[model samples]
Target: MTRPRLSAVSVLTFSALIILTGCFGPPAPAPTSTSAAPTTTAAPTTSPAARPTGVTSAPAAPLSTAAAPPSSAPASPPPTEEPVPGGLPEQVAPLIIYYVAVEDNGVSGPLIGCGDSLVATTTAPVRFTDQVRPSIEALLANKSRGVGLSGLVNVLYQSNLSYAGGELTGSTITINLTGQFMLGGVCDIPRAKAQLEYTAMAAAGATSAQVFVNGRPIDEVLSLT
Candidate 1:
């Protein structure tokens, strides 16, 4: 017996069904069984402790072993001497006093010429730097007990005159006096001037002298008196 031939449509339908079954086979091998990418967990993060406000840390300093130098202080000044009370004693030496000389037997005598009447005599020790003043004082004291040595006849002896002071400038010496000046006689004026001037000159070792009595010059007082 002879077999029958299949139609083209029936053959195509059977081929299509066989291809669909091969595409959908075994549920696609169960989707390959992936393990969900292994869930990654980060370690616990810890922060440092907070610091106090306005506080900062500083670096440590290095130490040294060298010694420091010594310093110099200022020196003090010396002490000065203090002045003493009542002053010191004056240096003294013998000084001369001038007087009018007269010719006499014992004590009292007649008037000698005024030009040649001066008699140099010794008195007690007086200050060296202040000889003129003390010499005048000695002359006025009229203590000369020597024979023919008389100053009592002078107007200064009777007038109660006192020595103010004296000054020696260059070769000239000046003698000052303050008191009531009276003239016992007209001749006494020259006698007084001579006595004072000569006495001051000898004491001061001066060549000349100017005598002022009561602020009036010797020459002026003599002219007026």
Candidate 2:
């Protein structure tokens, strides 16, 4: 029955308080960091309306509206004159052209004498400041139809006649003529009224010329038989 033991300095002070609680035991919880804190994974943020999956971009150019085309008006200079060395310029001249003389050697009958069967020829020159429209366009261009083989005979040659123009006023030169003024016989109505009134009065040196055919009155279209 003798139970009172424990005292080797209280069992060495309870064995140094159990060796200071196993050498400060609460600090053992710090080593439980299972290696996870270094995982910062936040660098993947790119969100500015995010567009870069397989990369496709390229569709912008489209602004034109249309409306620009109006600049065109600069052209006026043309009138200087002064330079004439070779030919054609001293105010040109020459352009007579008349015909109908066949007085026998090649007689085809009937024109007894419309001012003794006309004559004269000349042509090719023009511009004495415009000689009465080029001498009635060289008597309607019958350029002396071979001067009727030298005897003369432009009874308004081929007579499909045209020249519908002339005026000359002061000395009176009307001419005008259009077409269909025929008369191949019956002395071609006074040799076509004396070859268009002596070729419009020697081409408007006019002492009077009144032709008109088509407006009637080259003596009523040559009905003077």
Candidate 3:
């Protein structure tokens, strides 16, 4: 007995059913367990600290060891002295002056001659250099007293010699005479010169003396040592 042959349609239908079964086999299984998602942590960041406003820093120390300059010092002043005009200092001590004087004899009747120029004299104490003027003034003051020149009158003119002024320069003295200091008439020029010179030199303690008459040098011809 021969078996019956399957139809082509039936065969094709079985093959198609097998392929469809394989393709649609079973659903994929879900992930067994999800690990916690990896945590996303931003790396730690560094930031500068903030300072408050108006903060001040300490001052720095000086680098040098030298001291600060010293403050300037105050200044000082000058000195003074007492005034002494035409004279030595003051009269802390007394000084002496020599004045010519006259001596008399009953016979010669007042000893009038230059040979006795101040041969008879008086002495006095002085206080100032300027006092020299007045001292000489006193010596020649009273011609009638005849002290200044009477001793020399017989030899000299004795013109009532007048004293105008006098001044001293160091060791020198200058005496001025006015009013006919030429002596009325030149009799014994040398003796007249002696009378004045001796008196001034003695009173002033001068090394030398200059005489002026009528504002002019007494004639050099009349110069006395």
The prediction achieving the highest lDDT against the true structure is 1
lDDT of each: 0.67, 0.65, 0.56
Off by over 4 Å in 3: 1-86, 89-120, 123-129, 145-162, 182-187, 220-225
**Candidate with best TM-score:** 1
Across 89-178, the per-residue lDDT of candidate 2 in tens digits comes to: 447767776667655422443244543446667766566654656666666666344574576677666667777777778988887777
Task: List, residue by residue over 1-225, the lDDT tens digit for candidate 3.
Answer: 999999999999999999988999877686666756554543333522343334333456869988988768754556667755763654422323232233323243223343232352554555554555655665555354233443423223345556788888999999998765434433345446655666687767788888887787876535531
Clashing pairs in 1: none
Tens digits of lDDT, candidate 1, 68-183: 66557665668878957563346787777555553332233223444335555675666655677678887777633342434434446556678998777999998888876566
Clashes of 2: 0
The RMSD of every model to the true structure, in order and in angstroms, is 22.4, 15.2, 22.5
Error of 2 at 158 (Å): 27
lDDT-better candidate, 1 vs 3:
1
The C-alpha stretches of model 2 lying farther than 4 A from their native spots are 1-93, 99-102, 105-120, 128-132, 137-189, 192-194, 197-214, 217-225
Collision count for each candidate, in order: 0, 0, 5
- Which residue pairs overlap in candidate 2's backbone? none
Of 1 and 3, the candidate ranking higher by TM-score: 1
Q: How does model 1 score by TM-score?
A: 0.51
Query: Where does model 1 exceed 4 Å of error?
Result: 1-74, 78-89, 103-116, 143-155
Name the TM-score of candidate 2: 0.28
